[model samples]
Target: MQRNRSKRYRAAAQQVDRAKAYSLPEAVSTLKKFPPTKFDQTVTVSFRLGVDPKQSDQMVRGTCPLPHGSGKQVRVLVFAEGESAQAAREAGAEF
Candidate 1:
């Protein structure tokens, strides 16, 4: 049973590869046939900071890039004050 399943999976993968090579347009159109139901989906992501505090003057902060660009919009929040906040605003940050 396991061997049969493996054979079927390999055959399917090969068919996909052949389709990608021969009928690239059909393959892409078929993929785009399925429309996502939800447009705005919020996902939480985390990252680890491995910077040495003694060696580095500036500490690493904030969230990193998400896989597949999060498939959502991003809103940047800045808590800087005075000149720093003005600089951030000039740099095109929302807040």
Candidate 2:
């Protein structure tokens, strides 16, 4: 299905060469140059691995913590009442 993209998105897309495979640094630089949205956007990187879901041995899962933290800020929600709520706040829960 075709969906309309914002003018900003179209403009940003135009800046990158679709046929070219950019180095990691070059891709990041291109992304940083894009126009900002009204609200902050999450920077995501996705990969499509052809491993079959039915093959347990081929499943992928791992973590690589960056030496410098990711630029994204994480917001967490806690559901509690009275003392629990206060405890969560004291533990640094944002909301």
Candidate 3:
């Protein structure tokens, strides 16, 4: 199925050649060419490996260092009542 992309995404996509694999420096320079955004943006890089994950020898592994840390929202679920509940709320847990 064809997916609709925004004008900003379309313009950025056009800068890279999909048919060719870009080197580290090539990728960095291409991204540097883009205009800066008003707010902080996160960059996610994913590698496509040809190895089979089922095989013990070929374990899918890699870590992308997010300098700004993971944009993960953490939620706490407390199953307590009375004083315990009050303490949890004080510790930043949403009731």
Candidate 4:
């Protein structure tokens, strides 16, 4: 059982390493080639950013990277209503 677990972990780690070989820009470009679908509605990328500690909140900022660069040409459908809906629209969100 222990050996099986270790093998599973190693496989997962290898997959991550393969993904790391891809740059953010290249990944985003590849994703863009796909058409929008239910699954494609929300695609997130993860990466670390390099920043100066003194100038920023943290030297390394890590968050889900946008699969594509900002200013996505697709229209967004917001589910909020009333004030929240208005706020969403004000924030450049579409419905």
Candidate 2 positional error at 3, Å = 2.7
The local distance difference test score of model 4 is 0.66
Model 2, span 10-90: residue lDDT tens: 999899898987777888999999998999587877556778878899878899998778978888789999999999999
lDDT tens per residue, model 1, 9-70: 45545545442343556655644444343455442324345677676675665697857897
Shift in Å, residue 45, candidate 1: 27
> Alpha-carbon error at 14 in model 4, in Å?
16
Q: Looking at model 3, which ten-residue stretch has the lowest summed lDDT?
A: 38-47
Q: After superposition, how far is residue 23 of candidate 3 from its true place, in Å?
A: 1.6
lDDT of each: 0.61, 0.87, 0.84, 0.66
The TM-scores, one per candidate, come to 0.31, 0.48, 0.49, 0.29
**TM-score, cand. 2 vs. native:** 0.48
Residue pairs in steric clash, candidate 4? 45-65
Misplaced by over 4 Å in model 2 are 47-61, 66-95
lDDT per residue, candidate 3, 1-95, as tens digits?
99998787888888889898887788889989876767788687766779899999999777988777787878888888999999999898885
Q: Which candidate, 3 or 4, would have the higher lDDT against the true structure?
A: 3
TM-score-better candidate, 2 vs 3: 3
Write down the RMSD of all candidates, one decimal each.
Answer: 12.9, 7.5, 6.0, 11.0
What digit string (tens of lDDT, one per residue) describes model 4 on residues 1-95? 34555554465445444635578787677556554444427566665555567875665555876667676677888999899999999998978
Best by lDDT: 2
Off by over 4 Å in 3: 1-10, 62-95
Model 4: lDDT of residue 45: 65
Which segments of candidate 4 are over 4 A away from where they belong? 1-20, 50-95
Alpha-carbon error at 77 in model 2, in Å?
A: 18
